[model samples]
Target: MDVALVTSLKDGMNLVRYELVACQDSKRGVLILREFAGAAQSLGAGAILVNPWNITEVSNAIGQALDMEPEKREKRHNHNFLHVTTHTAQEWAETFVRYETILSMKLLLLFLGLLSLINQFCGTSLPLLVASSDIILVY
Candidate 1:
């Protein structure tokens, strides 16, 4: 696995970005991620985002990633590394608890309404709902 440059054309919740960030010993690798991927929302600041449908754009990104300076790579890697280290499962659970606790009735109603709409269209069960802070996958 060439962690030096990890590219994903398209993905739902790509864990490869996190894996690369965590495994980079020298923090001198480049991450080329698809803008449409779920991970892009978090890693976009540090990783090079490209459109999978645009070949020219992806090629240009590859060039940029390959030519990126060591200092820039390390800096980008550090940003992602810090996020990966800090945003642990425990932290996420605690944040969710706090968010849910402070959630106003109005907001909860809105969420439930959205969930209801989703369930109606997606044909998912409503008895149990699981969610992450950023995304919700009903299955």
Candidate 2:
């Protein structure tokens, strides 16, 4: 009976951290929510112990505990500049072709450069090799 325990903590106001502990059985595909409690006793932390069989109830309880009213906190949305926009069929095809061409050219150039370097060094001899060759020829 192999078991794995995973724990994650979220820091909240007043230097208190809330922990969620999950126990999973890899072979049996079972996920058990073992504990969700506060690290410190003095903080206004709560625990919602749940059975593994009642997944929906456990999820709803956790969601209700974590949700906040819109007016209570400032809502912020983060955006990234590199995010791709929706493209038409022709635009998507063009983008894919451009990336494939660039990537293939770069890889080909890299392999060609490596091959040239190997050819240059394959027959070159150092001073130690020349000395050894002279001794062998003399013998």
Candidate 3:
């Protein structure tokens, strides 16, 4: 950003002006500032540019103009919180389902251990128990 006090001499008369230029890097090229003689112009009243230099005032004016532009406003709405929250919720739910599946497998192993203890206490070589145990081991 560049702020300058310009003096133009016309017919032996000194015409003083305060000019502000703000620029930024863009994909296409460096985005040059819009000329002040157009629709958007400064409203400073003075015979000459006598105001104290203020970077903050120049920055605020540029910020306000860029924010009010239509393209920037649309881009802000496109990245709104509603879309971001929905994407985050889906990722969290997928993680929860994965942990629940791991817990269920651990519970199943504990139940099998209890059944094996009961078989040993009864002193029984149960045929159905042996076959089912083999099937569980294969899985």
Best by lDDT: 1
TM-score of each: 0.64, 0.29, 0.28
Single out the weakest 10-residue window by summed lDDT for candidate 1: 1-10
Native-vs-model 3 lDDT? 0.37
Ranking by TM-score: 1, 2, 3
Runs in model 2 lying further than 4 Å from the true structure: 1-86, 125-139
Deviating ranges (above 4 Å) for candidate 1: 1-10, 101-139
Ranking by lDDT: 1, 3, 2
Candidate 3: tens digits of C-alpha lDDT, residues 59-137: 5544554445555533432333223334455787998999999999987997788677666656655533333544543
Q: Could you tell me the TM-score of candidate 2?
A: 0.29
**Worst 10 contiguous positions by lDDT, candidate 2:** 75-84
TM-score of 3: 0.28
lDDT tens digits by residue: candidate 1, 1-139? 2234445654555577888888888546888887877877887898998887788998998889888888888888898888888887899999998888778766889789877867676764455455769876655
Give lDDT per model, in order.
0.77, 0.36, 0.37
Best by TM-score: 1
lDDT of 3 at 123: 66
